[model samples]
Structure formats: structure tokens, C-alpha cells
Target: MRLTTIGFDADDTLWQNEQFFRVTEERFADLLTDYAESKHLKQRLLEAEMRNLKLYGFGIKGFTLSMIETALDVTAGKVPTSTIATIMEIGRELLQHPIEPLAHAAETLETLSGRYRLVLVTKGDLFDQERKLAQSGLGDFFDGVEIVSDKTVETYVRVFNRHGDGPDKSMMVGNSLKSDVIPAIRAGGWGVFVPHALTWAFEREEPPVNEPRFREVPDLGALATVLAEIEST
Candidate 1:
């Protein structure tokens, strides 16, 4: 049967998300290196975020601020006023990061919208993803947008059935193996892993090496071609 619905992952999948986080983290590492190594600082920051998920939700802005707060508290007044200023500056730079769309993303979305029902299934801060969709102007391309709090097998099954004709006819495409591809595939939906060079460390994951149905595409533009083939077959 021809594919009727397609689901896409936002963030690094559609635009540059992790790159902004990485740049800010490097600046964070530089400033906190005196008090603690980058590795130590990152680990502590992860722990703090785990503790703050309910309090702050998600976003590079809040996460970076939490990292700075943790670093100062970790060192007991040794993180210094200057380092604090630098960290805030880095956070500002991060917020200012121009949301660059992935290669052929806009074109591909426009092309595919003509033929298939496309839904953007992304997990992150609600405000951030909404802002991104408004900025990219690709929001209109999707039949719907699922700003999930978390991406899991159950979520995929629910979303696919709710949005698509069924899991068998829906296709999920994104950069993350864990968040995008695996969950949807395991839910009995078709999945395409569109890899980005700068995937988030947490989002980075490997797919089953020899799954005949699983595909790894280079970018969104190629996605249109893939869909065409699927529809033909």
C-alpha cells in the first residue's frame, strides 16, 4: 500500500539544535575548567537536570543556566564572578543561535506535503519547539505536530494510530535512533534514520545493523525520493 502519513523529528532533525548546545557547553567547559574538568562538570550538570526536569522542563537556556548554577555551588565560591559572566555570555550566544534549517529540509517538506500527510513528532521544551516551527516556516507543511514530553514505544503507537491511517502506513524520519527511529519501528511503523553530523550525545544511538526495513538516509531532500519509492512499491 502507498504510504499515507509521515512523521518527522524536530531539533537536530529539522534544524541546528545540538550545535548550539555544544557551543555553549564548550564555553561552559572553558569557564569551569579551573574549578572542575569538563567531564566532571557535564556529569554534575546531567544530574542537576535530572533533578530539575519537573522544575524547568527542557531547553538549552534553562539547562545552561542550571549547569552554571551547579558549577558555582560545586566549587564553593571558587567559580568566580568573571567565570559567571562568561557562562552567561555563552548562554546568551546560545539563545541568539540562528535556527538554520537542515539541508534541503524546507524544499523536501514542501515537496512531500503535496503527496503525503506529514506530522512533526518532536520531544523537547514546548515553547522552544513552537518557536522553532514558527521560525522555520515549515510548520504549515505538517498535518499536525506532536510535541511529546518523551519519545517511547507507547507514544509512537498512540501517535501513529491517532495521526496516520495506521502504523503500517506511517513512516517516521529523524536523526536520533532512540527518540525517532527505534520507537516507531518497534511500534510497527516504517522508520527512516536521517543522520546529522552533529547529533546530540544523548540522542546518538545505533540501529539494528541488518534490519531490511530500516533505512538510513542522508538528508530530508532524499526523504521525498524515499517516500516516492515506498508509495510505488
Candidate 2:
């Protein structure tokens, strides 16, 4: 319970991210409706995303590529030029979307800033993540930012060691169990799961059964209380 540094995952945890993706996905489906059913198009796009994760990593750019690839696949490489243009436009719009902080995001960060060293630990395109962080207006509340390629036990360990004393004195807070919670816990740190209403399917994972260091909160507003309880234990 002697947490000295706390890391936060950006995307859905602190800001409005997935909703934009969902919107763009819906648009993508609409653009391709003539060639494929909505359900089938969605399935193919998701498959493309999963397949391209290693090659493109994660970001709007990668997502754009996946969408285009899916379009080509579904249309048998005969997708109209206008459709491609629209998909690219969708990507540009997504990239330029405003960064909207979630409710209590700033307040929670402000509250925690005084008590613990706060760091932003997130994954995605470096430039895009940096841009969002800059736009968030929450940058000053963080002691450091780690825009990693992926979240893993080793990744958390390295980040904790570099930014704080060690994983034993660190905690990670975020919405994803796969990327944020389980990895942090496995790295010998406490993990606070703040569930988001719209999580990407790829980021979903079942919480560990009966783990004391793993906590689930309704939202970021509950984080301070959870931390206080952990501190008292």
C-alpha cells in the first residue's frame, strides 16, 4: 500500500477516445455498405486491425490503413476511388479530433498530484499520443509521460523502475484489463481498474479472481477514495 508513484493510461481512461473510433468505424461501415453488410464489414475490419497490430502498432494511422485494407478486401480490390478518399478523410478527421477529458479527469489528477508522483503511461503513435497529451491540459499534473508501444509486465517493471523506486511502490490506473490492470499487477504493482462505457474489444479481459491489489472502481471519481482505502490498509 506504500504506493509512491501512480501511472495512468490515457485514451479512454482520461479522455474521450473510443467514442471517436466507434464513430469512425460506423462511418467506415456506411461507406462500404454497398459492398458488404454492416456486421460482415465490422468483422473484417476488426480482423484487419488485429492482423496489422504488429506491423503498424496502434494509432489512427494504423486504423486508417486497416479500414482501407478491409475495404479493398471486401470489394475484391475494386473499391471505388471515392470510397478510398472518404476513408482517408475519415482518418484525417479522427486525427484532428479534439481531445476531451473525461469527467473528473482533471480533478482527480490534481488531487493525486500532491500525494503521489503521477505519470502518463499509454501506447500509440508517439506523435498522436503526444499531441493528445498536450491538448489535454493535464500535462503539468504529470511528473513524466511514457508513450510505450505496448503494455506488458516487463514494460510496467521498466517504467516503474525508471520513474520511481520499483513496482512494489507503484500503481497503474486505467480502463483496460489487458493493457493496464493485469500487466501492472503481474509486475508487482497495484492496478486500479476504472471501467469505461465504451472499451475496444481488443482491450477487454476478465479481472483476476480474488486479488487484493487489484481494484475496480466505477469511474475516475472513485479513484481517490480507492487510493485512500489502499493507503489505510
Best by lDDT: 2
lDDT of 2: 0.94
Q: After superposition, how far is residue 70 of candidate 2 from its true place, in Å?
A: 0.4
Give lDDT tens digits, candidate 2, residues 1-233.
48899999999999989999999999999998889999999999999999999999989999999999999999999999999999999899999899999999999999989789899999999999999999999999999999998999999999999999899999999999999999999999999999999999999999975877899999899998988898898
CA error at residue 34 for candidate 2, angstroms: 1.0
Give the Å shift of residue 173 in candidate 1.
0.5
Name model 1 segments beyond 4 Å from true: 43-57, 73-78, 81-89
- Tell me the number of clashing residue pairs for each predicted model: 0, 0
RMSD of each: 2.4, 0.8
**TM-score of model 2 (CA atoms):** 0.98
lDDT of 1 by residue, 1-233 (tens): 77788899988888988877876777777777777788887788777877776677667666866877787777886777777777777776666677789888888888888688889998777877788889887888999999987888898888888888888788899989988888888888888998888865566677855764588788877886777777777
> Which candidate should be chosen as best, given TM-score against the real structure?
2
